[model samples]
Target: MGRKRTIKRDTVLDAAEQVVMRDGAARLTLDAVACEAGISKASVLYDYKTKQALIKAVVERRLAAHATCEQEVAASFSGDPDAAIRTRIEVASHLLTEEDRAVALGLLASLAQDADLREPIARTYGERIAQVTGHSRSPRGALLAFLAIEGLMSLEWLGLHDWAPEERARIIAEIGWLVDQVPAPVSAPASVLSSSPERSTR
Candidate 1:
C-alpha cells in the first residue's frame, strides 16, 4: 500500500498567508488554502477546524516571530537602561518588511471584523506598552516614542503613506534624538563637611 502524504501545519499557514496577501482576507477560505497548499481540503481541515482558527494561528505565529526578533534586538542593547524603547525603534526601523506589513494588513482586516480574533493582538499591544513604559528611565518620553513608532508603522500597513527611505530615516533619527533628550536622574550631592573637630578631616 502507498503511504499517505503528510503536510505540516506551517505549510497550511503559509498557504493561508499567501491567499490573504494575494486575494485579501475576505477571500480566504478552507478550500482556498487547500488549493494554495496543493493539498486536499480535508487535509487542511484536519489541522484547522475553522477559518477563524486558521487565521488566529497565523496571527499568533507572526506575533511569536516578531517577539523573537524583539528579543534579539534587546539582547544587542544589553546593559542599556533604555533597551526597551530603543529595541522598539530599531525593530520598527529595520526588522519590519513589506511582507510583514502586508500580513499585518491582512490580519488587521480579519481581526477588525471579528472581535474574538482581536483579543490576542490587543493583549500583545497592552503588554508591549507596559514593557516600553516600565523599563524606561523617562516613562513619558518612552511612551511618546512608542506611539510615534506605532503611528509610522500603521501608516505603511494601512497603505496611507509611502515614505521615502531618506525621509523615514530622518524621522526615525528625530525620534531617537527625542528619546535621548530624556534627562537622566540627578545624583545626590556629597555631604557638607562639619565644622566640629570630630567631623573635620586633618
Candidate 2:
C-alpha cells in the first residue's frame, strides 16, 4: 500500500528495457532484469507486482525520456508559437543522434508488442499534436506534420538520413510555412523539448 522507492522503480525499469531490447518482450523474465541490474530478483518484484507492471514501467520510462526532449524544445520559443514550432521541429530534427536512434528502436519495438503501451504512446504524441489546433491548419495538416516528423525520426534512427535528406529538409522546412498559415501559437514552451538543439547529427 505504501509507495515503492524511486531507486527500485528505476532499477527494475532499466533492467526491463535491457531485457526487452535484447531478448524481446515475449521472453522477458524478472530474474533476467534483476540479474542484469545487479539487484535481487525480489527487489524487482517489490517495485512491480507483476510482469505486466514491470513492462508498463519500462514503457513509461522510455516515453518520458522522449517527452523530456520535446518539452525542452517547447520551452525554447516562449512567446512565438510558430517560431517556437519551427524551433521545435528544428530541434527534433537535430536530435537524431545515433544513440537516440537505437533507444527509439528499442522503445518502438517494445510498444509494438505491448498493447498497454498503445495509450501512453498515443497520448505522448496526441499531447504534442494538440499544441497546434484550429482551422488555420486542418487536423490533417497537423497530422501530416506529426507523421512527417515521425518518418524523419524513423529514417534517422535507421541511419538512412542521407537516403532522403533533401526530402526531409523540405518537408520540415514547410512546417514553418504551415505555421504561418495557422493562427496564434501554443503557449510558451514549458521546456527545451520544444527547442531541442541538435542532439542527433551525421
Candidate 3:
C-alpha cells in the first residue's frame, strides 16, 4: 500500500516558487525543498516524480492563475470589446507590478534553455493575445499587439531590461494608451434597404 498525504500540491509548488524566485533556478532541488518544507525527500517525490515534473507543474499552476486573471479581465469587459482591450492593458500592468512577476520570472529562468518549452510559452501568450485581439481590427493588428505586449513583458521578466522606475511607469502608460487607440471594427448591415416601403408604394 502507498502512503497518503493531506497537504495541497500547491503548497509544495508555492514553496518551490519561493526557493526559485529568491535563490534562482540553479538551486532548485528536491532535497532543498523537502528540507524547507519539513518533509522527507520521499514525500516530495510522491508529489512530483522528477525535477522537470515539478518545474512543469509550476508552469501549469501559472497557466491556471493566468486563466483566472483572464476571466477577471473578461468580467471587466462585460461583453464590450473596447472595454475588454482596456481591461487587458490593466491586467498586463497589474501583472508587471512588484512581486506579481516573481513566479513568472522564476519559471522563465527554469525553462530558458529548453526548445521544448517554447510551445507551451507561445501557446500561453497566444491565448492571451486571442483574448485581447478578438476585438482588434485586422488579424495582423491583433497579432502585432500581442507580440508587442509579450516582448515588453519578456524583457521585464528576464532581468535583461534597464528601464528606470519612471521609465517603466511611462511604458505602462504609453501601452495602455496605445492599445486603446486601436479602433474597433464598425459593423453594418450588408444590404442598403428602401427607407419606407408604404410611402414608396403610394
Candidate 4:
C-alpha cells in the first residue's frame, strides 16, 4: 500500500520558509526541508514534487498572507477605493518582524533566480494602482502619491538607507497628507459652459 499523506502542506511550507530564511534560498533542498519539518523525505516529495514547485508554493503563500492583510485594511475603510494605498503605507511604516523581513529577502532571492517569480507581485501592484486611481478624484495626484510611497519602500528594501524613527514617522505623515491632496476634477468655466459656436454665415 502507498504511504498515507500525514503532513499538512502549510507545515511543509513553513519549514521551507525557515530553511530559506536561515540557509538562503540557494541552499534549500529536500533533505534540508525534511529535516526542518521533521518529516520523511518522501513526505516532502509527496507534498512538493520538486524544489521549483516548493519555491512557487512559498511565493503563493506569502502573497496570500499579504492579500489578506490588504483586504483587512481595505475593509476598515468601508469600501473606499483609496483604502489599499493607505493600507500599504500603514503596513510599510509599521515595524516589520524578522520573519516578515526574512520572507521578503527569501522572495527576492527567488526572484533573482527566476524572473517568473515576480509576476504575482507585479500583478498585485498593478491591481493596487488601478484601485488607487479609480478612487482618487485626481488620478494624477494619486499616482504620484503611490509612486512616492513605493520609492521610499524600495529604498528600505534595497538597504540603501535607514531613517530614524522620528524621521520615518514624519515621512509617513507627509505621505498621508500627499495622498489626501488629490483634488476633485476641475470643471469648465461658466463662460465656456454657456458659450456656443456662433452660426457660420457665408
lDDT of 3 by residue, 149-177 (tens): 66777787766674777776677677655
Instruction: Write one digit per residue (lDDT tens) for candidate 1, span 76-165.
Output: 999887898899899888735778878777777779889888888899999989987888888778888888999998888788898888
Candidate 2: stretches off by over 4 Å? 1-7, 107-110, 134-143, 157-171, 181-202
- Cand. 4 Cα-lDDT: 0.80
RMSD of 4: 9.1
Q: Which ten residues in a row have the lowest lDDT in candidate 3?
A: 190-199
74-165 per-residue lDDT for model 2 (tens digits): 67765654433454576656646554455456556556766776777788667666665432235545545556666766777766655466
How many backbone clashes does every candidate have? 0, 20, 0, 0
Better of 2 and 3 by TM-score: 3
Give the Cα-based TM-score of candidate 1 against the true structure: 0.83
Predicted structure 3: lDDT: 0.68
* Model 4, span 91-134: residue lDDT tens: 77775666876777766777876867777778878898888888
Measured over all alpha carbons after superposition, the RMSD of each candidate to the real structure, in angstroms, is 12.7, 12.3, 12.2, 9.1
Between the candidate structures 3 and 4, which one is better when assessed by lDDT? Answer: 4
Estimate TM-scores for all models: 0.83, 0.68, 0.72, 0.81
lDDT preference between candidates 2 and 4, better one: 4
Question: How would you order the candidates by lDDT, starting with the best?
Answer: 1, 4, 3, 2
lDDT of each: 0.86, 0.65, 0.68, 0.80
- Model 2 reaches what TM-score against the true structure? 0.68
Best by TM-score: 1
